[model samples]
Target: MKRLTLIAAAVAAAAAMHAPLAPAADKPVSIGKLERVATFDGAMPTGVTVTETGRIFVNFPRWGDDVPYTVAELRDGKAVPYPDAAVNVADPADPAKGFISVQSVVADGRGRVWILDTAAPEFKAPRRGGAKLVAVDLASNRIVKTVVFPAEVVLPSTYVNDMRFDFRAGAEGVAYVTDSSLSGPGAIIVLDLATGKAVRRLNGHPATMPEPGFAAAIDGKPLPATFKVASDGIALSPDGDTLYFCALSSRRLYSVPTRLLRDPNVTEAELARAVRDLGVKGASDGLESDAAGAVYAGDYEHNAIRKLARGSTTWRTIARGENLSWPDTLSVGPDGYLYVIANQLHRQAGFNDGRDLRRKPYELLRVKVNAQPAPTN
Candidate 1:
């Protein structure tokens, strides 16, 4: 406990060395009822992750925040501004703006929270001093590091949506992320943390490219699948050998050997050659593989969570549609449960051509993985 305290103190001190933060909001928070956890409205909660200390982190990307639901650290039950104190980095007069338009959140090995901020709204040109990854020390719920991406690594139209860490890669921890930019073809952006270097691979490959001429059919007619071109969700297998990914609007799921992705020496063509088509499409918006090797997919088309059996194309809906909004990101939390966000994204005004269809408060839900959970009988 003493060691933990020391580490926490060190991280807190580091965050404090940073700049002055914006003032906190002064509104009466409505935490709603518990037992059956109520929802909170996020303009678009694209990613969801939980910390070991049980604090939940959820984000709102480019979408405009009518209510201040940007990046929030859920403490007790209130989604409050984090750090509790403003940080003054180089100068108070040149203080950084508060966290806003965050795309995804993940808990790393050291108990710190990592946030991927798209920075720019709607995958626009990278903004000045924006488009970076921020980490918060769990012990004090404070910001510790802000790693920015170079212009070369992020295309003008790039959208760094979701990311996963592979600590054993590149002599230091490496991060694999999906561009998921709707602008057409997207690239897999790999980050070398030790040196803050990044590279893009498979930018225009057929695999990374959006599904050609694909149209999302939901209300009896063809609709744009959120993004213009489609590529969105990604996941790493439990054993960390294969990287599973799917286009949000396509009917195919694919896996490529992680060896090729982590191998900087490998050519994009070589990486593409390593991809193996996995034949299970759960209408997945987000995909995740739990410790048990079960892939939990949130099927927005069916409004449920589906599981793909190991070593098989067989897929089954594990959790059916139950008041779920448009399910977005998926994560296997430290508590061993499958967590997902139902943001009602597809039903949003942009998808509906400027009419807000979201009724339920965007919610973060947990489904108890049925015990002895053999991938569906």
Candidate 2:
């Protein structure tokens, strides 16, 4: 009878100890406030950029969705066709003339917005005249220049993912592009704004390629083995000295000197040696920098946004929420906020056994960061 009483008392003590701590441990401690700026009920949006005047622009890649226009400007709570509706229409014969599956849009801070068109809808082989970079004048709202990539630079498997501009580089400026190809190796393409000349750098480098056998766990479930993505996120430092990038399937971050990348005399071997692994920053899809020198990234695995502050190697979470599902892109707005897009990419049919588990109304959210966009000019 005494032994039975002791067992009951021990059980009661164990239950009392477990009950209070479990609930508190499981609850997430949210940091910064996540403010919803817009909600997408139709197509899933990937990239977002904000101009100095606070004009919000977003892009919708041709990934099986019924995207009316590839790029739109969010004005008065509507995704209005940017610049005009005519340029948004794609012409198969003259793919370079129109926006064919634009992947990213960036405001140059020099009174222009650059649009990167992949020209490879549904991740298919790019059309000859399709892959191009276009610049539009914000004041005139007209396309000022269109620089099409050479057939050699844009390979059949190349998917031009994201880009950043450095107006301080050369005569007119320079743009860095990421080729996040899934079927082939990944690379960075450096484009001279003056001559429209482009060259591939660090092609097939392990830093740019997807981590072998890497699988991201989303919602406590591991991504399928078939899922793989290469160097998808790219950003530039405030002074345009270092270029930071990371692969989609990897947690590691890397950077190289901008001068070495811009040097035409630098060989691929020399450039590869210059690459620096900056340690793991969680699984990120989009990366951005601010004038304060902080590098921001979307922590999709944790449903949060993290930042590597200037001079700090340790990453710190700035914001977190349940609605931050698959935070696909990050943009530092001029209004001192870090904007992000939560598109729920893992719930798509491609990742979920051909059954789309995505619910409607993906989100565009922002958190106060008290920083300005990195200056390019």
Compare the candidates by lDDT and give the number of the best one.
2
Give lDDT tens digits, candidate 2, residues 91-204: 867888999899999999988889999998899998887899999999999999999987778999999999999989889999999999988889899999888889888888
lDDT of 1 by residue, 306-369 (tens): 6776765666555544455457887665655667787777676777878877775777777766
Model 1's lDDT to the true fold?
A: 0.65
How much is 173 displaced in model 2, in angstroms?
A: 0.7
Model 2 lDDT-worst window of ten: 17-26
Give the count of colliding residue pairs in each prediction: 8, 0
Q: What lDDT score is found at residue 268 in candidate 1?
A: 82
Off by over 4 Å in 2: 1-29
For each candidate, what TM-score against the reference?
Answer: 0.81, 0.92
Give the Å shift of residue 351 in candidate 2: 0.7
